[model samples]
Target: MNSDHYTYRVTWSAEDAEHVGLCAEFPSLSWLAATPAEALAGIRSVVADCVRDMSAHGEPVPVPLADRRYSGEFKVRIPPEQHRRLAIEASEQGVSLNRLVSAKLASGA
Candidate 1:
């Protein structure tokens, strides 16, 4: 697994009074530093070490989020009443429920 392809994020930690680095693929791993750059570097190093150890032990390493493929379709459950309401709204708009829902999600609703 390429650690460089993993999803990384840097954010401030008020409680720690420092920056924190996070890897989405390794939710349990984190690094803290006084600077964002250092925090990111630290996390990347840690991830690299972890990957090496796992590989040496014949353990399966996690696939980076960037390397994963996502299907466009996913199932979501909602109350029957809400589903009915959405169906009615889609009908009123002259569109399929899927299209209406897709548009809403795209708009970050």
Candidate 2:
């Protein structure tokens, strides 16, 4: 990553109410979780273990998260008629419904 460009977010969560844990995932990076806060802190030390036993010789190391930018997910509801119309337009344009909607919105449709 260019350090100026991309960002990823990983919200920590326990496996269950009784457990303590942290969870993290990124689009272009690896995923990991810890049973305790200390386990998460141990990432740097344990990363070497993952690399040492790796089948590939040139594997990269996992670095600590430095940025927290995120495009959070939200729900948008549309009437069935509107959805059908968007789908038909998308099919006519040889694109997916999402692509069509994105294009139309970007074009002030």
**What would the per-residue lDDT of candidate 1 be over residues 3-107, giving only the tens digit for each residue?**
899989999999999999999989999999999999999999999999999999999999987788999899999999999999999999999999999999999
How much is 69 displaced in model 2, in angstroms? Answer: 2.5
Among these predictions, the greatest lDDT belongs to 1
User: After best superposition, candidate 1 residue 106: deviation in angstroms?
Assistant: 1.5
In candidate 2, position 69 carries an lDDT of 46
lDDT of 2 by residue, 11-97 (tens): 454553332222232233333554444444444234434445542566553442555445653567999999999899899999998
Candidate 2 lDDT: 0.51
Clashing residue pairs in candidate 2 (N, C-alpha, C atoms within 3 angstroms): none
Q: TM-score, each model?
A: 0.96, 0.35
- Model 1 RMSD vs true structure: 0.8
What lDDT does each candidate get?
0.95, 0.51
